[model samples]
Target: MSQRNYRAAIVGTGAIAHAHAQALLGSGRAELVAVADVDARRAAEFAGKYGGPSTHAGLDDLLREEQVDVVHLCTPPQLHAPLAIACLEAGVTALVEKPPTLSLAEFDAVIEAERRSTAHVATVLQHRFGAGALRLRRLQEAGELGRPLLATCNTQWYRDEAYYAVPWRGTWESEGGGPTMGHGIHQFDLLFSVLGPWREVTAVAARQARPVDTEDVSLALVTFENGAVATIVNSVVSPRQTSQLRFDYERATVEVEHLYGYTDDDWTVTPAPGQEGVSELWAEGRTTTSSGHDGWLAAVFDALDRGEAPPVTAEDTRRTMEFIAALYASAFTGERVQAGQIAADSPFARRMDGTGAPWEKVRNP
Candidate 1:
């Protein structure tokens, strides 16, 4: 098939939008044709800085006027579904940011919209595309790591009261859940990508620091279907910020440690006992920096050109979202939540905090 340059656009001119713009421009597989934001000035300013892309005050105008092949939805969590649906309905593929939607219910709606449209929706879970992560996955799939036994995913970052000054920063209705949904989600998504589907989750959530309606910290014990258990900690109260994931397989232990993003150097492989040769095998393939949006976008464009479903498809993202729902459900109900337990009617599925925001009643410590 002849390669065609894909035309792209970005919606929502927020902080993350810049990353999207950079990745789209750098990917070379696609051209950023336009950018849209509710704030006309912000849109115009972003366009001025990004170069070449036109600007629109609203997505309606951009979708109606531009012939865009893909759109990066960089808006707040609450706006992801509606905006993504709009793009998909307009026959444009959508690549949404993390916490893809405020809740699983909202995500389901996005999936239904996708079924009726020619275009597809893919969530941004960039960590899965990193070179180290990809290598780890290959080793695991090849049975070189043996059967996975244990894992840990920690997203410990600091977000002060000032950081929540943004209207949607720490709210159940807007930003979705706190660190579990927003920050740690990247690490956990990568964890799930490597470990596979989770079977159950038991969790606890708290408003440990920030005076936000959502919990600033959460901890969960997840049991994967493969019988491997993982301890997950999501927190915005830690003074030292880091994104870490460690998987202990039968033959070797693979670990990645970095803040925000990672590179080849961030990954380490330690063999168990007499299994020293595993280290050499782990380094056998291509070595590249940690994958980011650019790496994922390159793959997305390749899939588009081939008329294939893009990476991080809704079905793929649903596992991560389902885990988020199960975490919140288990935390709020004080019960172990099983996968597929959060039906459409479940309060946690409908909203992150269940029936009501817990922090609303408790005084911030």
Candidate 2:
């Protein structure tokens, strides 16, 4: 594919939208032709800050006015599915942020929309694009890391009441399932990329610290199809915060420790006895900075240029979302949930909280 510039637009002007705008501007792969938000002023401000692209009060107006080849859905979780569907239907590819939708059913709807249109939709699982992560995946696939036996993923960060003051921060009906669905999902997505499909999960969740309808902290034990086991933790109450993932393979233990994003320096490889050369092999790869929206945008633009579906495809994103659904189902019903257990008709398929809002009872008391 020849190197050609594609016109792009951002659909929401929130805090994360700036990251999207800067990434698009920095990549030189796409031109930020426009921005849209419910607030016309916010859209204008975003345009002014990021090269003065056209601005509109809503996405529909932007879509109608601009010749956008790609649309970034930076809106809240609830709006992700519908807006993405709209973009794909109009023959424009969509790149959505994490917690792509409110439920598994909604994600399926986005997939259906993609199938009906020529354009494709991709979710933002940026951690999978980092050079360290890419190299680790390559090593594992080549059997250089041996077999992945056990792993731990933790997204333990701090979020106070003031952060939840946003209307959609804590509700199951809007923001999905708190940190498990929102914050830690980035780390878990990276874990899934390395470990592959999960088989079953058992979990427990609670609204221990924050006054919200979703769990502020949750823990789950997951069994993978490859016979590997993992313990996953998502929390927003920790005073000492970190986003960490540790994988214990037969020959070496690979770990990445960083708060938001990670570079090569943040990764550590400790080989077992007689495997001293593993560290040198781990460092044998192209070096790039920590993965973020910029890396993801580069991939998305390349895929578009090649006329192929981008990275973090709907099928891949569904596995992560299904794992999330299984976690919520297991946490709420006190049962082991399988990967395919949550179907379109299942209670958890409709909402992350499942059939009841257990947190509601505690909040009322």
Candidate 3:
């Protein structure tokens, strides 16, 4: 007997939703049966373009009409939590976009919703699904890389004023945060997955040169639970753009440089003086899966087929989300933040900027 194929739907017919549609079609494990968008024309156009899947004006209508096994919440950052909660309530899985929720408190609520339902919620941190990341993690877990010591995660991309003119491109209330939360999250999530949990974060954020309310640039010094120290830089004001991550282990230094997604060729493993053997191990069991929405969804589909929770589980993603919160907390508060420190009552838990960003005064005045 053939394995059962699942039915999937895309909730927002945006650019990212197209990626989800393509991935769903390519997976062979799922079929795109329906899509929903607030704009009727957009939904119809997306449906027509992608095999004429049924289209609806809203998620409620889609849920009411289609027997969807999973719903890809490709909407804006702010809509992720509510839509995901709704999916959970309907006993349907929700594969949400990154920065899963606007705040830690919002994420906790989504977790609660998941607990009450038979469904699960997974975030789209596609970087962790790449071949390079998978290989590094496998080697690191097997003690092939020795101990991790230092690392750097940098996302330096340029976005002009016209990009921020979209209204939702840069705002705490709408988009959740600046580049730290929106753009650089992929690199840092991969970092967190490889290094385990973080211990503390000291950071700073500035609007820099962007014509927006949120910071265009932010930097941080992070200490991991395993004693590895890493520096992070998130910026949208750089002239030249690149997304880079470097991990310096006792035996080897691994690095990948790419602007967006990465393949195996983008990665390099340089062994220590006496640990030249590490390079061969790095290239031995490699696959061609590049980091993107498709590869990540494939892993998610595998878990669903096994009646298991998805790869980027809520607990694992919460750690990364917490790190994001802590980065902003430390940046705006001018104090180092520790893991499990953003209590429900804390301002950072409610909002990324806590009471208000320090630069808010300068911008308002």
- The global C-alpha lDDT for each of the candidates, from Candidate 1 onward, is 0.89, 0.92, 0.92
What TM-scores do the predictions have? 0.97, 0.98, 0.98
**Model 2 stretches astray by more than 4 angstroms:** 286-288, 362-365
lDDT of 2 at 189: 94
Tens-place lDDT digits, model 1, residues 99-196: 89999889999999999999999999899988898889898898898999999999999989999999888888898889999999999999999999
Scored by Cα lDDT, where does model 2 land?
Answer: 0.92
Q: Write the per-residue lDDT of candidate 3 for residues 1-365, one digit (tens) a residue.
A: 24569999999898888888999898888889999999999999999999999999889999999999999999989899999999999999999998799898999999999999999999999999988998899999999999999999999999999999897888999988999889988889899999999999999999989878788999999999899999999999998999999999999999999988999989999999999999999989777767988889888988887888997999998998899899999988789999999999999989988878888976677
Relative to the true structure, candidate 2 reaches a TM of: 0.98
Q: Residues 82-161, candidate 2, lDDT per residue (tens digit)?
A: 99999998999999999899999999999999999999999998999998898899999999989999999999999999
RMSD for each of the candidates: 1.7, 1.2, 1.2
